[model samples]
Target: MKKKYVRLISRAAVWSPRFGGLAFLILLFSILLQRFSVIDVTVFMILIIISACCVVVSLFFAVKALYSLWVYGALGGMKALRGIIYSLTTAIPLVLFWGFWFTLPALHDVSTDIQRPPTFFRTARPSDALPLKSVLIEQAALQMSQWPEMSGRRYDGSPDRIRESVLNVLAAYDWPVIAQKKFKGEEDELYIETVAKSFYLGFISDIVIRLIDEGDTTFVDMRSASRYLPRDFGANAAFIIDFMEALDTEIALLPLSQDEK
Candidate 1:
């Protein structure tokens, strides 16, 4: 009985990698289908369902192979160990791939200023774009407490100079610059809109960066939002962080004015 059980587990371990490969192929195909608009939401969902099932089954077999090694002690020889290791080699990537999203917030729309997010210039913005719907007081409070540094930055530079810096940073990332406008009044407002693509499904995310001249300082506000989904998986927040970091780096490299220095 013990030998038969071990044999079954060993065979499952051998097949685990193939299951993992199938899961990966499904995921890739789904992404490609979505990228070209070849698949509807139902088809995409079905792909995900099938892929997830394959990954779960692969991991189960992998774990079972490892458990077999544990149960039989060292008697199963190196074959058992090799089977578990082979199973893990394929299953780990998929497990980690799906597991990563669990760590992200379910809320998709992330903004520097929740009160007044940067407005989109497009004719048909996503419904989730800008001016978030009111939430519970506790939820609002929690967000405020969590993302205090997410607010816009005010730098000691003219609007034109600041706008140039913003453009440089956005362009560096190869984000598609959708629209840019400089509105003149008592103080100029520089508005730039961009569409950023995701790596997984090539999904489109809209981003707007606004620069308001305040004479001595330029106030920079940026908002990133996904067009399709309710959850961005922290992409918006990460986008802002990367842009801000790169912007700061770019600005710091610039020669400071005598007065500013």
Candidate 2:
């Protein structure tokens, strides 16, 4: 009977290694998560240390459990503690590390940005060749970068307030304003020209706002350019808000039904 009991314990110990191996694999993933760049470096580093300790501690417990069960013919408390320790420690860091690791990078991808501005040779003007005006606008919009503000970092103002503020600025600057027909859909393209110096300026909307100077109007545009607007305003932020506000203003003036909302 004693020999049979010992044989059973030895087999369980052999199988016990499989559990530790699986847990080690999970710990490896957690370690990699801690290395991601978008994760807050401080948080990641702290968790990384914790995770390393967890891996080592879990391994110790696992080995202790096997040794106690198979080598000594008894598990003591190590058998239960082994699964509990390894699972809890591994699970916690794995969830936390990967959560921040994947989320931040996707949220802040520079390519997705549409609020950056393009370089401009000068301020865009109505005069000169139409081809030049079209090309400049197209190129400028293409170069625009995404706005980086997230839900947490967003300003107190809503899109409506922002649009109103922007329009008020445009009116203050004596810049001719036109209300877009709609939100300009996902992509908004425009060709506007103002005659000024020999240099001309063009603007585009994307993650970053790109401005290109095509003619003698090397001067920056104060109305549409971020230089004239708020630095936090993203590529489509100003344009979208202002357009939406203009639509609302037009609707208010029309005396439409309240049910429309």
Question: For each candidate, what is the lDDT?
Answer: 0.70, 0.37
Best by lDDT: 1
List model 2 lDDT by residue over 137-233, tens digit each.
Answer: 3333333433332111122223333334435544543445433222233333222322111011112222221112322211112223322111212
Error of 2 at 39 (Å): 13
Question: What TM-score does candidate 1 get on C-alpha atoms?
Answer: 0.68
The sequence of per-residue lDDT tens digits that candidate 1 reaches over residues 107-151 is 566677666666776636645444444332334555566565566
Candidate 2: where is the Cα deviation over 4 Å?
Answer: 1-40, 78-83, 86-89, 92-261
The 10-residue segment of model 2 with minimum total lDDT is 193-202
- Candidate 2, position 184, lDDT: 34
The segments of candidate 1 whose C-alpha lies over 4 angstroms from its true place after superposition are 1-21, 31-45, 56-94, 123-148, 183-187, 199-201, 256-261
lDDT, residue 220, candidate 2: 17
